[model samples]
Target: MYSRIGLTGDVMLGRLVDQYHQQRPVVAVWGDLLDQLRALDGLFINLECCLSNRGEPWQRTQRAFHFRADPDWAVPALERAGVDCCALANNHILDFEEEALRDTLDHLDARNIAYAGAGRTRAEAFEPALVTVNELDVAFVSFTDNTPEYAATETSPGTAYVEIDIGDEETRAAVQETLNRAREHDPDLVIASLHWGPNMVEEPPDTFQKFGRWLIDEGVDIIHGHSAHIFQGIEVYRGRPILYDTGDFVDDYAVDERLRNDRSFLFEVVVSPTGDLSELRLQPTEIHDRSVHEADDEAAKWSRGRMRDLSTPFGTSFERDGEQLVVDFNS
Candidate 1:
């Protein structure tokens, strides 16, 4: 009766990626990882784009990018990969303005795919998305620290945004308030899907690390972090796993030669029937031609080595189990 849930970082289905889908199949974005993703009991992703065919790019500030995917193909592509829920608190969610954000919400709603973070109003944006994974009820609360301009107000449509600094009493209180809101769902597990920090940074700053640990101490079962285009280390605080940054799952961004932003892991967490997290399995993956697939030999080797080196400083270790890097909780 064990259940497995898949988690991924930014999955952008706009711009060139959307163009590629026009010529390829709906499942082409996921490549060989499609079957594995479909096999999970539930899957959560940081959806990095709006799903809509309307609306103009935001010109409020000096924003340089606007990402909007046609729901006709994007929705089906998400369904093909068995995406159960999405975190929509990233900077790009409202890149195309409120109309596109509303469209994204409507499309996900129509497909029965739950989402948290950006919403029509502040209350809805701060609300958690609940989903059942087997017999376990899991809750997801999302937030972003990068886009304060996109922060939801009382009656306006926007993202759930917050500043992360555990040292500051206000920020600590804010984090507690967010967790308190999610706790109202009475879920078996709570995941704080955070889209924070700058892009392409390999290591998280000390402030972020402190904040992540503080969130765990406050009650979050897992800290699912992203927004850094490159993957960071995995840290297990107490018994909960903190995925600092999962990197870009599917996108058309320019690759950083040194950081290898094109490579990351498809994370799977195994939960015992009792709802306790048992183990974590990371399947290395690489992005090419706007498609994501299981990493080949050289890429896999690089992924494993990089992940190990990054995680080692945190006192975290991994054991390779066939093609997957495993972190056993029971041991």
Candidate 2:
């Protein structure tokens, strides 16, 4: 048996979606992307903003951005796209503070959508979201290396955090302990959704690469990393897939033409019932006018070439498979 899982990078629906595209239906904004996502056995994404109408912005003079989407619009849109679960461990999830984080949880709960990496207490924040597809139990655990100030505590509400300082033994031990606990659940597959790395950097840092390999050694079967606004690279360590940064799937931010931040991909991982990866494919994508569309010939070529350059160091290659790019592991 095989299970096809669709994954995407940061999805910011607050400022721009509410401002310009709120009038448009969610399906329209997602366009053909919705059909492709719905066809998968399961779909997951980083919910990069709070879904609420309450709470004030973080009281920081230097804060540059705060994002929140009206639950009325965001929830339905997510449902229409057949999103199975959302990872809430990103920086913007707490932009509206504790009240809005609670509201976001409430709305996701009311809509019957599963979410992980954020909760009212530290324990909940560390919990993993588990979903079964094709009789395979898959677990998702998320953590952010940015903004330790927004992390959850025993009595506070916030996102789960993993300290990025590789030399910090205590932080590394705590993260490993969490993964160990998740491993105790005996899931067929485990995926770590990490919100890390600097924005627009062409390559992933050495520390991140080391931490990812450590997670795989400890138990994680796949590493779904994001936070970088552009596509980074792919690494196949042992047999698991590690997506360094998937880039922005949908957003309203003005594009930086020089960085080509507009280029992105919709990653689809096909896993066998035994928990081994059978295939990995990427659907070249682009964000335009606050919506997602299939990338054109030139854009597709560029996206594929960038991924090839990044993945070559990890000994991973790509081959065109119709409209999508397939990973060539050369088994």
Candidate 3:
């Protein structure tokens, strides 16, 4: 009855990454990590780009970049990795506007890939994607605090947007409503996939930490957080884990020499037979030539050290299990 769920930060297949796909096979994007991803019972990632060929860049507001990939290759790339679900409530989903967003939805639907956070309407945007793995029913809901202009209206198409201020009663009420909707499915576990906060930061603000704890109090089993380009620390509250920031998984963005945005982890959560989270294992990974792969020895060492320093503040400890870092919750 145990289930292994794999989670990653952002998976953006657009711009330069898309160009590389033309020269190489779609599966090349995963490099040697393809087999590792497929080993999990379920995998969820924040799909950080729109898969479409239509629509112009969003001109409704001042935007610096727009990411859109051809569905022909992008959808196959996702399928190749055995992506069970995608969190589409990111800042880049509507980079090419509503037309591209609709196309993204259609492409995922054709592949039977469950996605949440963005949709044709506000109500649809807030809906959850329920999945079953090893008889464990998991509910996933996505939300982003970025790009307020991309927020969906009653009749428009956009993402599930919410401000992350815990002090705001309105924000709390909205989250409660979304939780209520997700509870309707009677899921064994509820995962809140959030694309919040600014990018390139090292740690979450105090408000975000409070908010993450509050979400757990409100019945969320896990908080999958990202947006900051660098991975942050892990905090376990009330027997649930909150991944503050997972950093970039697969992207072509320029590397920040010091921050090393390319360094990340493939997080695997082991859910016990009793439906409680048992262990968290992190397999170090690094992006190279627009593809993701297992981190080399040096990169893996750096990741292990950095994670130890970052997580120690929360009183979290880990044991090196070969190439992977293991955190046992039952300890």
TM-scores of all predicted structures: 0.98, 0.96, 0.98
The global Cα lDDT (0 to 1) of model 2 is 0.86
- How far residue 142's Cα lies from its native spot in candidate 3, in Å, is 0.6
C-alpha-based local distance difference test score of model 1: 0.92
Give one digit per residue, the lDDT tens place, for model 2 in 204-318: 8898898888888888988999998998889999888889999999888878886688889999999887877888999999988788888988998888888888899988877
State candidate 2's TM-score: 0.96
Q: Kindly report which residue stretches of model 3 are placed more than 4 angstroms away from their true locations once superposed.
A: none
- Candidate 1 on 38-149: residue-level lDDT in tens? 9999999999999999999999988988898989999999998999999999999999999999999999999999999889998899888999999999989898898899
- Candidate whose TM-score is highest: 3
Which candidate model has the greater lDDT, 2 or 3? 3
How many angstroms is residue 101 displaced in model 1 relative to the true structure, after the best TM-score fit?
Answer: 0.5
| Candidate 3 lDDT tens digits, 1-331 | 7899999999989999998886788889999999999889999999999999999999989998888888888899899899989999989999999999999999999998999999999989998998887789899999999999999989999999998988888788778898998898888899999999998998888989999999999999989999998899999898788999999999999999989999999999999866799999999999998999999999999999998999898888898999999989898
**Model 2: CA > 4 A from native:** 328-330
